[model samples]
Target chain A: MTAVVPPAPPARLCPSLAAVYRAQLSRARGARIPLLFVATFQSIGIMVLMRGVVDGGDGDEARAVVAGSAVLVVAFVALNLLAQYFGQLRATGGLDHYATLPVPAAAVALGTAAAYASFTVPGVVVTAVCGALLYQLPMGGLWVLLAVVPLAGAALAGLGAALGLLAPRPELATLCGQLGMSAALLLGVLPEARLPEPVRWLRDLLPSTYGVDALATALEPGPDWGSVAADLAVCAGVGVAALALATWAYRRAALR
Target chain B: MASSIARPWPGLAAPEHTPDGTASAPAAFTVRGLTKTYPARRLKRSRTAAEPAAPASDRITLDVARGEIFGLLGPNGAGKTTLVKQLTGLLRPDSGAITLLGHDLVRHPRRAARLLAYLGQESTALDELTVALAAETTARLRGLDAGAARRERDAVIEELGLGPIASRPLKRLSGGERRLACVAAALTGSRPVLVLDEPTAGMDPVARRAVWAAVDRRRALDGTTVVLVTHNVIEAETVLDRVAVLDAGRVIACDTPDGLKALVGTEVRLDLVWRGEPPLAVREIAALRHLAAVAGRRWTLRLPPDRARAVVAAVTQGPAFAALDDFTLATPSLEDVYLALGGRGEGLVRS
Candidate 1:
């Protein structure tokens, strides 16, 4: 006689990260229209201001121009953080509603991180193109440029998610974002030579520092793969660790 | 004479049993010794300071049967939502067991997730998404294919009478419509168990009826078990097969609607409007044993299940009772049952 086994229970259904990514993309696209308009006009204005100063410069002058544009990119990123976090706080409801879904806390955190990353795409592209046009730097490695930009944006987005999770309320999140942006801009974008040793060391620890460094290396006449790889690794590590913390914090809050 | 006839039904043959040998039919869900305690701050006013904190949500247990619409009746701060959260896996219990479809809740939450759908008190749908999109998203989250997701969304929309406004963004919908959209999202996958917390709040009579009809259809067509947390006793009377009345995080009473009403031991008041003054013989006829009290132009009779018909016959046939202008009988309703089970004052406010 043969024995019959009962069938296994049906598998649980969980939404894929791609679906969460898509939902975030749709939301970001809606919120980015005005931000894009402002970034376009701002990029054009910066390009016009830089055209005369570069004046078909030599390699040394070109290096200086690229460095200056990196500073501009860092500043632009800071502005992006300010606008994105404040707008999200004012426009969307708090994350309390998402906690009720059967989705894991990590998925919710990843969704918001992906949304912030998507919002940065237009600004980063415009800044890169404007920097190349104004400084007459090499732009042949388009694929590499694409890869580096997203990694940097992911790092920044993860930091934003961590901040959003830690802040007591939406208003507090906006305030903290503004303060952090101010500190980063002060240390990194201001003339580096004038900063003291301790301040310079602190700036190096910021994720924005690595992002600005990678952008400069990407636009240089000769590609610096070593520096690029180092920056990308550091940024990626920060992003993963911060995102993991945010996920854990969110889970603790929801479960409590 | 009537009292003698009312004492034999309990001795009759019992109902047939199932193959499993349990006295009652097997229930779809059974919970034992469930407990959830949340740390809450204790606020105290003194000369200098406030006190610290304490634990809430003491131990509680419940059982629900197949196709039974059970109400978890409670007032504010009664831990009804906390229990619902634990049952849906949003929060873990401090201790105890919950078995649904024979699967342990804590050890096998993922398996339990497939069979249960929870509609939380908040309308959790995205405001920017259209009603159809919201329903389709939830269906997809429940792992339905694209085609199946659309079909299920359409079916739920139609069932909830949301077809007319299906394409409208959730932000544009009225409060009731928004609540219905949330319910539609929860119901799209057609899971076998539904945990609804005040689903009918903010709904008009028409919308409320539509929600009840959808629940009825789900139960009848699929034998789905529904656990409803509602305070609307009037509407609940028509739909609930049984109820668990809760007070201060405790289950005060759990029973079939008829059984709970029986616990109240309420009597039917027969108001006999006799013309002028009636004869003393009629008063004597109303004074039968087991009848609690007889007053002016009214006889309050405690009619047990067996004595109801005989009592009515004797009152109508007695000669002195011939001058009656009108007579009416009032039995215990669900509201009375609710009040009898210690749910009174502010607790009786219908949702």
Candidate 2:
């Protein structure tokens, strides 16, 4: 009898990173409702504290406080990043399932990064509203700054992906997240002119520095377009590099 | 006297066939000198801690035919999973080529993945996702539209008998149900080739039978090719068109179940029950050329398929051993074929 040969399989149209991000957004919004509530409350609390402290200060001093508060919001962004990474990894075993699919590993990483960015939407809105009302910050070019928010988030999400890939486990990822937020707070949130040269140089490497600087530029009375441009460049550059590294790391791990 | 003879079943011998009647099946999957080596770091005794790593897999080669349920049977850490991982595109081979469904698996993984579906030993589904959702997600990931994915998921859930628990979260299901979910997810896209790693490992008998029945149905209905990595011989024998027994990262025996069993030939054990003592001249009676060996009260006689009645006639004619209580003629089973092929320890049985 003649042998029966099986036919080839059809080509696959992979689900985009946007889809993965949407799924992650839905999951995070579902599981961490309490966390989101606390972060919103904390954003309001920080705005109130800034309002109380800025009453007797000069305009420049109030500007610094508003900028520093924007930097402090990095802590919330960092927490969201950690939560998204851990949540995805906990669902699928360390991105291996996504890696094995017909889609590119870069797409999976990008999709996950997009999802991470999506999770920070609530924090960005709350922080923006709080900063406007309590700090009396100038709101010109606020729409441009709002557009930059998701871009900054994308950069941070890429960084989180790199950390998730490099760290041995989820707990280590949490520790790294803590260290990252503390460093960002020290460098970006605090008045940079008051900090030492080495600390400033260290802060220069952080994506949060660009995020805080961009928000400050947009909210300043004159709306510094040059500073916004520079921050956007830095954020996009760091995001691309982190995403490449994360894709490389994920490929190595999955193909092992 | 029975021990004096070596060649039994001489009557059933047939002339070997020429090559014209025996056409070899073409290989659907071919692995040529495949090797996957993982690094093993060795610690140094010097004050400066330093070590070098080594590779894990040596060169291995295998071929599987179309429509064959090839079993890659091996114990834990025998590199079966590693080999399967390489085939499924989950891991890249260090060297060598693997062609599946007319495409090189490594060079054109997407093409290969289109034809192949892998059900890993560990379930690959989000715990919080419902069974239907998980299956639908897999179908969607495989490029099925939402409507098609829903229809396919429903069909698979029904096939797996998981309709009752389709809406429950996977973590809430029992272990068997979870495994069935993985199976349903693997079968979601209706890929022609399936690579299942211990698919029935933790299943009950009913579940196992159900899975086998499904496999049989798939093979008969769609001519789907299957590669089953299992140590469960009895279950595997039920549906396996052929078996490939793997040991130490190499295939030891590859053949049809009956073909392998035929290697042991036919041996009949005659249990005699005389008034008191067993026959004395029974040894002389067994000394006929048809007998292979006689041990204690039991006599193991090999009878050619055609002369089996003659041997029975000779044994029954004996006045010295007229009262033969019970006699059983036995042929080698798949398990016997496995053991005889040098599968030892706990290797032949599933855990």
Candidate 3:
């Protein structure tokens, strides 16, 4: 007689998350390579262009420019690409697959976000290092990116996922993603001192701004560790809230 | 095992779900009073009725036995897919109770996911993965260990004859091949219930046989319960142990194929394929035109068995035989049952 082992119960959150992460990582590795390259080069190109207008390594404008450009790489992949990814996923009925699985909704959303975020590591690191050299900023505190990349990636990926899942149509989701990346560029890449009060207030609302602020604070010869921690904490909070919203959006889309 | 529900409809045996209900044993699934309506939406804002959209599933109730193949046969827009989705816990009903394998599915959709393996009608999921990987991942996702997952994946791939395309991405496969890959994935884990919505939609006859054979193997070996949603009346007649025919979002008839067919009485249908237009016999035309439905080169006529024999002999042995390419006199089919039950054949294509 053939042995018929019954199916086990639905996987718990951790194992499900790990399985989803591995699958997404393997699937996206090849597809996202060229895009990650573009993201990295785009950040470098912006930093070089800003180098013409804003002249030196030791100034506050230089710090903002380098930091903002570095975090912009994270925004490109985690927010823009991830948004398009989820939008296409929802449009193509991909969410139905996850909804049918025994995995938790959080696992599906978080695993995808983590996979897209993973692509940004090389881009963010390379951009930070190259921007430091081009803008003549101190590279001493560049270690701050170890914290900044994930925090910002999480916050932005969650927002991207939410936009894709909540949008009624895939084209609208793509538009939302582009608008989001543009906001990151205008608010994050520009020096805070040069912005109008209202626009600066808008800058405070963008999740990547906290990442840029934390990185800029770390670029000083002697970094303000307390300010950096506070900024990192806010990014972490936004990341969590946004991810939760994404999970909710996923449920809404899947259940429909 | 058997199950029952309270609400009673004509043309079906009283469903037994509770103490007051009629089922005698344990059932794999019990759905009661399931109703879902899509709310009306206005893209441009107009004064429309405050009424909701037509109900997609209107008070569907059924009990699927533990190991039998139960088919959901319907015309398009008959709410078959909606009912299937509700049964699989992918869509929630506005009001009703669904109990699958002793779990309250409406209350716990995640548990439903664990207990059921579903192959949707049209899926682009797992399009990034190769056929082998899609099957393997599904096994793993269903909580199989690595060894078992791999074993099941290999078994399903070979069973489906997908070895040639196993390495290719689902996105790169033909529509039928992609659907086959999805079937392979859905069959990996030995879940108690399998919900297949048009599993053989894009498949050729050979592939359709493979898909059904794989499902039959699961049913025989593992005693799996299958809830199939299909518009293929022929397949439904040949394979379904029991079937529910739906029209306009309601179950028009539910019974064993024979039981439903019995509703059509002793009538038989004669189908004729003509090499050219039907013969221009005025007498034959006057006698049969009102009862027969003629569409170009094909003609269908329903009558008593004795009259069917006479008509068959008349068509085959006479001058009319010269115009006939083929002819079949068959007993009432599930489609005939639907027709007898007041279905207009709007969405149920008779293959």
Candidate 4:
């Protein structure tokens, strides 16, 4: 007869970062995939509508439209969704689960942001490819989009997380996320020459605009890698700072 | 009656010592001068504005011995949840020190976290994940490897009889099912100390028994220390090695279940059924506090232990002795002690 045995002892501390990232990724697999598809389809639809209006535009105009449309996908999946997710989590008392765990607050915040941002990659790539094809722009430096998606996602997702954490109600959080996405749309999709000087400065302030600038520059026929690198650097710096702020917000929300 | 206390309470004096006079086991948790205050959200306008707001948890202190199942009993809004949250490191205390498993909770909360598993009163966290995933994920987060997490999850699911809804999302389950799933997640981990807050609140009898059985298994097998915060004091009394009664943010009393029960020493209850023609002498017995004489057939009475013999003789010594049926003499229970100390018994309050 076989004797029953107790299971082996498990680790006392929270799992490693890879485990947390894996868990978050798996959790978002079902909920995020459909949202990514919607984002991709929305960006492609915008490009199709703008095609007739920008049919006989300069290369700069074409680059702006394509880059703006592509980055909009990142705004939708990374910024908008992440803000709403964290807001709902806080409102519903879901943060207590992580707070009680042995994991660091940074892991919970960073892992969630990274997972949500990662989902935007597919939509960003699809929109970039489709937008360039429709606008008749050069795709020579399009490989630069690989860096643009995550860096921009980090910047936007971080803001969304902070907004969500600070919002008193989940509904308010959703509104903030929508406003952020709309700002991305208005500032990012339009060619810079069409905007007034003041509004152009506002566009420069938007984090996604830097992402748009990088991707748009990469699409130029004689792309200046130096300028693109600078734009990407700004995006990276903003992403890191925004994520740090989001993590701080997470700690504050937990205390509350 | 005044000398009935077996020993000076741990709060009034040092903790009760074992026969060897050495402290039994190392304390699983030690809380001292733990105080937390929040701004009075519903302050009465008539009060003097200069008065300080009341603390949510007053200067509370206690020690829970290792391998002991300790029950934390209190009424609603008695700072029970607040205190447990502080113990689990989810809430910070305004002023105090907490040491859990020998690690200072405030200074090294991560280290303390590794030693404790908490089941909160609410189950919102489980709603997003499937029952199996929720249990498995919590197990993983507690430091279980992939294979061990799955094994523990499966074991807990089977123990809790959650197989039917194991694959379903927690949001879709009934409230009791969700509670059972939460219990499964909490108990599946091997953390040395477990704090469960109102775990049986929504469970059915079968599920409640399952939860208690699992906790009992953990205690018996690994000598795991458990801190159970519960409203179901009657059920909790069966397994509790020691209990602390909290009222208005302070620990009023802490003792073994028997010790608590013994506070109202030998207070017996007599239940009787009367037939037709209720005897005047039995009905007029001064010591008997009559319950209900339904249809002149059933009757229950509560009285002091010293009056029991006199009342029993009064009923049986008369012609109505044969009329009495289903007579039962009962000793006092934990509920009696709870009502006498933690609740409305104002005279039993300790400083």
lDDT: worst 10-residue window of model 3 chain B: B2-11
Give the CAPRI class of candidate 3.
acceptable
Which prediction has the highest DockQ against the true structure?
A: 3
lDDT of 4 by residue, A33-152 (tens): 777788889888888888878873347777888999999988987788888988998988778776776666677677778888888888888898888788777778899988998899
Pairs with backbone N, CA or C atoms under 3 Å apart (clashes), candidate 4:
none
**Please, what are the lDDT tens digits per residue for candidate 2 over residues A163-239?**
76667666777677767766665565456677789888887887777877777677767776887888888877877
Candidate 1 per-residue lDDT, tens place, B109-220, comes to 5445566778877653366567888788767666566788789988999888898999887767898888888888878777767899888878888888888889888777
Off by over 4 Å in 4: A1-15, A33-45, A48-52, A56-59, A133-141, A166-172, B1-23, B42-52, B265-335, B342-351
Compare candidates 1 and 2 on lDDT and give the better one: 2
**Against the hidden true structure, what lDDT does model 1 obtain?**
0.62
lDDT computed for candidate 3? 0.83
Ranking by DockQ: 3, 4, 2, 1
Question: Per-residue lDDT for A210 in model 1?
Answer: 67
TM-score, one value per model? 0.72, 0.73, 0.88, 0.79
lDDT of 1 at A123: 62
Q: What's the true lDDT of residue B122 in model 3?
A: 53
TM-score of 4: 0.79
By TM-score, how accurate is candidate 2? Answer: 0.73
- Winner on DockQ (1 vs 2): 2
- Model 1 residue runs over 4 Å out of place are A1-15, A29-106, A130-145, A166-176, A221-225, B1-23, B42-56, B107-111, B265-336, B344-347
Higher-DockQ candidate of 2 and 4 = 4
Tens digits of lDDT, candidate 2, B1-351: 111112211221222221333313444567777877775444566665444333334566666665567777655665778888888877788788877755677786545555678887665335556788778777776667678878999998888888889888777788887888888887877776788988887777777777887877776666567888877767666667677665556566777777777776664333333344445567545455244444445555545555666556656766644745545555555656655577653466622
Q: What's the DockQ of model 1?
A: 0.09
> Which is superior by lDDT, 1 or 4?
4
Q: What is the Cα-based lDDT of residue B337 in candidate 4?
A: 70
